[model samples]
Target: MAAGAPRIFVSHLSGVAVFDPAGDQVGRVRDLVVMLRVAQRPPRLLGLVVELATRRRIFLPMTRVTAIQSGQVITTGVLNVRRFEQRPTERLVFGELLDRRVVLTETGEEVTVLDLSVHQLPARREWEIDRVFVRKGRKGSAFRRAKGEALTVEWTAVSGFSLEEQGQGAENLLATFEQLRPADLANVLHHLSPKRRAEVAAALDDDRLADVLEELPEDDQIEILGKLKEERAADVLEAMDPDDAADLLGELPTDEQERLLSLMQPGDAADMRRLMSYEDRTAGGLMTTEPIVLRPDATVADALARVRNPDLSPALAAQVYVCRPPDETPTGKYLGTVHFQRLLREPPPSLVSSIVDSDLQPLDPDADLPAIAGFFATYDMVAAPVVDEAGSLLGAVTVDDVLDHMLPEDWRETEFHLAEEEVATDGS
Candidate 1:
């Protein structure tokens, strides 16, 4: 739903047919998977448990859900057909939450939960269970049978559903730190014992773990990845940024790397393989294969919409590469660049090619680290396109990648140590 759509009660979504972009029915949503948070904070709506035609159930992440219309759910068409397994921190909304008894925090009145309401947060694609639909008077089956006072209240008004802030286990700890930045979360993980670290890593959803792994030290990344189930490891790798995922895969044993690659989606595996073929410090090595690419005929509005994607980093979103036909990288031709600023200044209907910044030179795939750094410094560019000799746009290198490669290998360790020292100083 768009920003204007009303908050929807979960009951309305029961057994909703889910469809791909092509209008083909993929499956029916059997249940919603939500992660409960500490205190009275609303739980995050993780995704849906979808049952396929053959009765196989798979987990569909909230990220892949594009829309929920009157009677059907729309997806991005990408799916992982693995069986849905509930994690320690996950609760099935249909199986675990409904027909449960809860208490109103203020009035101390017991109520039976009939359903919950979910709202998609406006800024990003994340959705959360924000409201509870409950009925008062007699509890249990009696309440279901008899008419009773029913009202929808903010999720915070009910106290029974939240996991306690002081509760034991990694799930509780994970809930407490749910709002942390990935870097801060990585620091927390760095300080946790090996077993606790593994527990927390396992509890995190694939996207979250991918973010944390990117910020972690190389050794820690390997350690955490090694502890994950092989299939889960592959899923997490696919969730990660292509460049970071490639770097992680490059560090693994050849046999293990192949094993994980075999589990990943073919397209993602191909990107990893291509990236691994490049020298570690070269432009090809550092660039992401998923840079936003648009055909010359695409409008500024189209570019703006692509840039607005929440998954992209600021560097990646800074500019969009305009190319020829075959918008996917390596695109047909390295046409030119259209910086975000330029897109903003132009009329929405303006063709991207009309205002392209053709003068700035693109980087060669084999451009060395120092050379890439110099290009960024000389152009004062946050990101620059990488083009091959055949004039196809290979990818785009961002300044962040350059900084990552230029930094000392032990930098994350140093940062973790410094954070620990500061915390100890505060305690002292």
Candidate 2:
């Protein structure tokens, strides 16, 4: 159970029969279900689907198994009859496993795995359990625990399996999706093409896809939007940031944009239109409309109270933002930001001005790409504050937005070479 350990091939896994310690025969293994495709390490077996004599299928986790005997597999955990309960037709396959917490024994890392992918191998015309990706914990958490461990274990290393023995395991996975790492998820989305992006969007229910879409890049955003029907696209847009919604609509053809906008709720459409009018690089354009705002005179204690509120936006809750009273120009009178970590370390009754940044540089609304890039590199900031000529805070530009404009010249060339090699192998 190390990083990049080679697992025994599925060809070597045939005829592994299953039985109980009481010597009651259960079923034989049919095939493996690998969730990941391209992994840094070996795959994880989700479980074995035993073909029962009654024409029913029993899902058994490899961890429940005690030994792989020549003719029968011995198990320690009793197969619960309740687990065989059929879900209603409305539920998705593996719906209960998403966002669940799992003790990844191999890496000793704990995280909620947001989703599971199944991989089908073409060579053996067989399926194998694949990789498991970890979700990152919340921002500004004191512990900063990793969502998943880096090490990958073969399906065989699973020593045991059971829910809390109090509840079902499937239920646990669904509750932890929000704890997943947005960046890792962004990378997973990055590897997919427009076609596959469309397929994935189609397969996922709108609510689940909406959650995942917010973590993806603008390019991927455009691709997913393009593929979805007008109503479906509108639903996702409704859940996204106003700025994100605008950016996605702007990328579409003008007629289609109007059509999509028409399909959206009136309130959502209006907000998107407002954000769309500004240049994408501007603070007014990129800043989320949903930032947590407080009067300049609010005490740090009051701010802390607000931060702890679950209703506050995750971004602003992690890093508190202070602003002057809403005037004719909101951006011209904007104040500085303080990390939530900083607030926790200091006295609670401190005034907002004491923690506010006095000399923070504000971004120009119309600053070109190089200037924006220079600002990020200059400040070494994960997010840079944006402002107009009046010295008001408009919005913030994130490192991810900068990355959209900075692709390497040889990126496609490298991909082309890989594609050519694939073609050659197939021809041979």
Candidate 3:
């Protein structure tokens, strides 16, 4: 659901029909899986358990759900189809939460949970249980019941749903640091005990884990990856940036690398093979194959729309490469480049080729790290295109990749926590 979508009560979601993009009915909602937090913070709505026509129940991640309406849920048509197994930190809404007894924080009265309301975070895809509807009186027997007052309250107004058993489990730790950026989260993981690190890593969703893995040191990356089940490990790799994924694969034994590659999509595996073929320090290895490539005839409006993508890194979005027929990497003869600023200055309808900066020499696939750094420094460019002898654009290397190679191997050992603590001391 988007920012302005209505909050949904879990009672209304039960047994709702689920449809794919093609409007074909795939299944019916079975239950919702959510992760409870340490404190009163609302639990995150992870996904739904949907039972298919064959009565096989599978987990559908919230990321794939496009919309949730009165009687139906729409998906992206990419269901995993694997049996839904409850993770250690996960809970089922209908089976466990409804009719549960808990105390309201504002008042000393105990209440029975009748339902929970979930909503997507503004401008983000993550959904969380935000409200609790409860009955204020005692639970009635099968035939005889007591009439009770009912009301809805914020999730934080209730306390029993959070940590009541273990004081310091992976779930609590994850919730405590859930809002941290991937790099910061990776840093926290680096400092934890290996067992705790692996536990936390296992609990994170695939896309989030992939992002955190990219920011982690090589040793940490390998340790966490090895701890995961092979199939899930492969899925995480596919979610990662191609260049980063290739780097991780290169660190593994050839047989192990091949095993993981075999599990990936054919196109992704091919990209990995091509990337791993190059020397580690060369432009071909450092660059990402999924750069923004547009045909020369594309208008500035098209280029700007692509740049507006929230997923693109700042460096990758800095400019776009104009090429011939094929748009993927090793694209047809490279035409030129149009920086984001240039695109902005030109009319929306103007052809990108007209303002293309063809003067700058593109980097060769074999260009070494020193040479790549020199090109960035000389041109003051955040990113530069890499082209092969046949003039096909191979990929683009950004300044960050160059810096990663240039930095000392032990640079990750710098303790960010100490700096934060020092600032805290001074403030006191």
Candidate 4:
């Protein structure tokens, strides 16, 4: 490439808007396909995975790209609608390379692969990896310490780790997916063939698997669950939120569901049964039984500690249910709820009951979806407590779960596709 030629980082390439020669928007760049070569040689650019408005992904070979500029890629309009498939020799820049471990050729030190710069080769139209931007310490250590500096070195100075070379049964590939968000990991799993999806799922731990499974569509959820051993599947189900586990079990055959439920611990099995008894569109079906709860007399300090748990979803952690004794679900009596904001504003020594929102009415377990939706809209609450007729605290319905049921059946899949387009448009 000419010295003056502008180079683009692979990270920035992702979500760039692709336009036809006539300036009509085609799709957004999701990933770049590349072919690895001998040591010290840059990988060859193969094509672009363009996600269309219809949520269909297609391949756009490099030859079809007329020009590559900041925030946008110009293509020849002539495109192949066939779905992009990875060949034996190809690797995805965003999916496989970013945040991966690569060895520095000179010191043999392993650094986290941060980003890659690609440019057209000198005197030729072919684009190849030009430079690699990497961080020196263990993954995520840089962020925890400070905004550590990055080392920009020639691609040849670092050795790339390829999953294919490590073999099909390699567990190392799981490490790559660990860096991705559950939704993004679900997208990667959705694109893989059933066999590959199972392999990847098997490599993940129960918690991670449960998280990714929750993000997947019902069909994908059923398929992946079907792939696991009965015992392991039960464990993953147990690791999932009670409401989500119930939702998945509801999709399976009665016999299959029974077998899986039987394998789970009795307490978990009972929780699943209780959730399963409710209609799918009701508050009882959508609420998670694991909301943070405390006795009304508990200190604000206790409420803050519970909210500090990293595992709690933002919506679930936004408020704490103040119940009577027997604080576990079917908590003795639903007293009221204390918003997280109140906990922060009041002194730590203050009793939770003093700050509780007793005026906020709790929803009945049998409340319909419309009632649940209106409750959230009217109260402007991220979560609300669910109660039995006797006013015993059962669980809490989060806005996320409510929206999950309110949206269309294929909403997750549709939203994922639309999000990419929105990013593309916003970047443009």
Best by TM-score: 1
Give TM per candidate. Answer: 0.96, 0.48, 0.83, 0.62
**Candidate rank order under TM-score:** 1, 3, 4, 2
lDDT of 2 by residue, 1-428 (tens): 11233434343344566678788777666544323212123233445556666656665544355555355667754452212323211122234444455555665645555443334343222234554444545322446644423333433332222223243232233222223444444444456666655655564434446656766655666777777767668866776666666777787889988898887777667767767878766555665555555667877888787676543345446665677866223433777776677788778778876888757766776776678788878876656666667766555666655664466534433544565678789999
Measured with C-alpha atoms, the lDDT of residue 357 in candidate 1 is 93
Tens-digit per-residue lDDT, 32-61, candidate 4:
987665435677676789999888898787
Off by over 4 Å in 4: 1-172, 416-428
RMSD of 1: 1.6
Q: lDDT of all predictions, in order shown?
A: 0.92, 0.56, 0.89, 0.84
Displacement of residue 386 (Cα, Å) in model 3 is: 3.0
Candidate 3 lDDT, tens digit per residue, 256-353? 99899887877888999999999998999999998999998899999998897656789999999999979899899998899999988999999999
How much does candidate 3 score in TM-score? 0.83
Model 1, span 297-324: residue lDDT tens: 8999999999987889999999999889
Q: Model 4 shows how many backbone clashes?
A: 1
Error of 3 at 131 (Å): 1.6
Residue 147 Cα positional deviation in candidate 3, in Å, after optimal superposition: 5.1
Candidate 4, clashing residue pairs?
1-122
Better of 1 and 4 by lDDT: 1
